[model samples]
Target: MKTIAVLGLGKIGSLAAVLLRQAGLQVTGFDQAAKALHDIPVLSDDISSPEVLKCLCADHDAVLSCLPYHLNAMVAAAAHQAGIHYFDLTEDVSTTGFIRELSARGNSLMAPQCGLAPGFVGIVGASLVAGFDECRSLRMRVGALPQNPTGLMGYAFNWSPEGVVNEYLNDCEVIEDGERKLVSAMEWLETLYIDGVKLEAFTTSGGLGTMCETYHGRIANLDYKSMRYPGHVQLMNFFFHELLMRERRDIAGEILTNAKPPVDQDVVYVHVAAEGLVSGALRRSEFVRTYRPIEIGGKPRTAIAWTTSASVVAVIEMVRNGSLPQNGFLKQEDIPLDRFLETDTGRLFN
Candidate 1:
């Protein structure tokens, strides 16, 4: 069995630990909070120090981080020194670039952005561009939303508040006219109509992954953004930038998390569209997916869990089976979409 060490026993980490154990991997879970993993049997150690984490990861085949972006560099460094493959769900651009640099000196794979948008969305977009000639443009959008809204914001706490704040405050990377550029956050506001629902989306950081850099000089236009209900973006802009809550983000995050009720019922929206020439004719292809709450392990798992956990699981299988290239930085687009969606674990996304 392939032993895996999952760092951080937060929300995503707990779900991943359970799923990985079910997949027959000897899972060792580490987290600061002892109460978080009381129900799980793998909480035998605490990864409090970098040296301790390095030793723990040395005995495992891989190390998966579900910690915040601030901890990714340390985790990746430890994994590099231990010669174990590393994976994370961070959307931070600079952190990812640093990991890319770390990958050059290691004998292990360092794959970041292994979550919904940066992970699965990138794979789907790459699949659309496959076997196509004269590619025109590609647009990708994803969202984790509450199934029913009762609050004024029309949403619930489905994911990390810090992550949402980062998306709004950071400069989003996009491709325009085949050139990579940085656009101000909360600027490219646009309304989108999906499934008869009038939703809104705008510029957000880290959603584009390495697509902008990868597709530069190839595709004319490529962009990724977060999907929200109408009026959400304007309200956030007012609070984050206008009201200068960006200066006091921790308080803002606390306010939002405290006010926003957590909901068990949720939905994940996925839409990837590509326009190009096929067989000497102009054509466009799209993949639209919607996933709802499902019961797993006799308990309900949110759509985000289903999507995000499925992503890392797919990559883990790829690396374990030699299907994915090892010993370097691996981008999400490097994985084939069809092969991903066809995997036993990836079927959760389907």
Candidate 2:
């Protein structure tokens, strides 16, 4: 059996271990916290430590990290040293760039930003361009929302809170006039209606993956943003920026995590729109996907967990199936759209 090691057994990491084990890989997990993995064995080691991570990677065919964005470089470096394929779900632009540089010369694959936004969002965007010849504009929006929002924030903690704050504060990368430009985060707000329910979308970091780089000079006015219920932007901005909670992210995270509970009845909303000429005719293609809570093996998993896990699983399958280059950096756009939507796990989005 192929052996795989997962670093960081947090919420997402824990789910990933279960999914990979179910997929028939011999899995070993390492994390700072003592985790419950049912029948699977847990390896007590700190992956953030370079020495220990290198040793752990030495015995595994590949290393999948579910740690925060800040810890991704450490794991990537260790994976590079151990000659193992490295994969992560980070959306930090700088971190993805570093991973790209490492992939340029590495002997094994390094795939990052393989989560919901940079992950599945990229796949949808590329698919849109494939069907249209003279592409005009492409818009992609996604949200992991609580089914019953009961707080002033009107949200719950489904994923990384720190990751949420980083995305809000960072400058977003966009493609306008067929050129790359950095747009101020939280600007360019727009109201959207999904399923006849109103929601707001705005600039957020790393949701576009290398789309801007891939679609540059090919299309104009291509952008990606995060979606939230109406008034979420104004409320969050007041708390994050005005209250200066932006600097105290850890505190803000703690407060939110303590006040707002994680909900099982949550949904993941995906919307992709592409406008261009098809067969010498002006046209547009729009795909909207919403994943609700699903029960796998009597356990209820949120849409965020399902979507996020599938993102990494799909990419890993692609690499294993020889659909992607075995060595060096791999961009999300490097994976074909149809192939992605055709994979056994990829069909979940459908």
In lDDT terms, which candidate is top? 2
RMSD of each: 1.7, 1.5
Model 1: CA > 4 A from native: 35-40, 44-46
lDDT of 2 by residue, 1-350 (tens): 27788887876777777777776678888877666687667877766677888788888989898888998988898888877898999999998888888887768989898888899888878887888878999999998899877756778888888888888888999998887999977888999888887889999988998888888888988998899888888987888889998888778877767777688889889999999998899998998977898865457778899889877877777777788888988888778878876776677777
Query: Residue 281 of model 1: what lDDT?
Result: 99
lDDT of 1 by residue, 84-175 (tens): 88999999999999999999998888999988878989999998988578788998888788878665577777888888788878999888
Residue pairs clashing, model 2: 103-329
lDDT of 1: 0.83
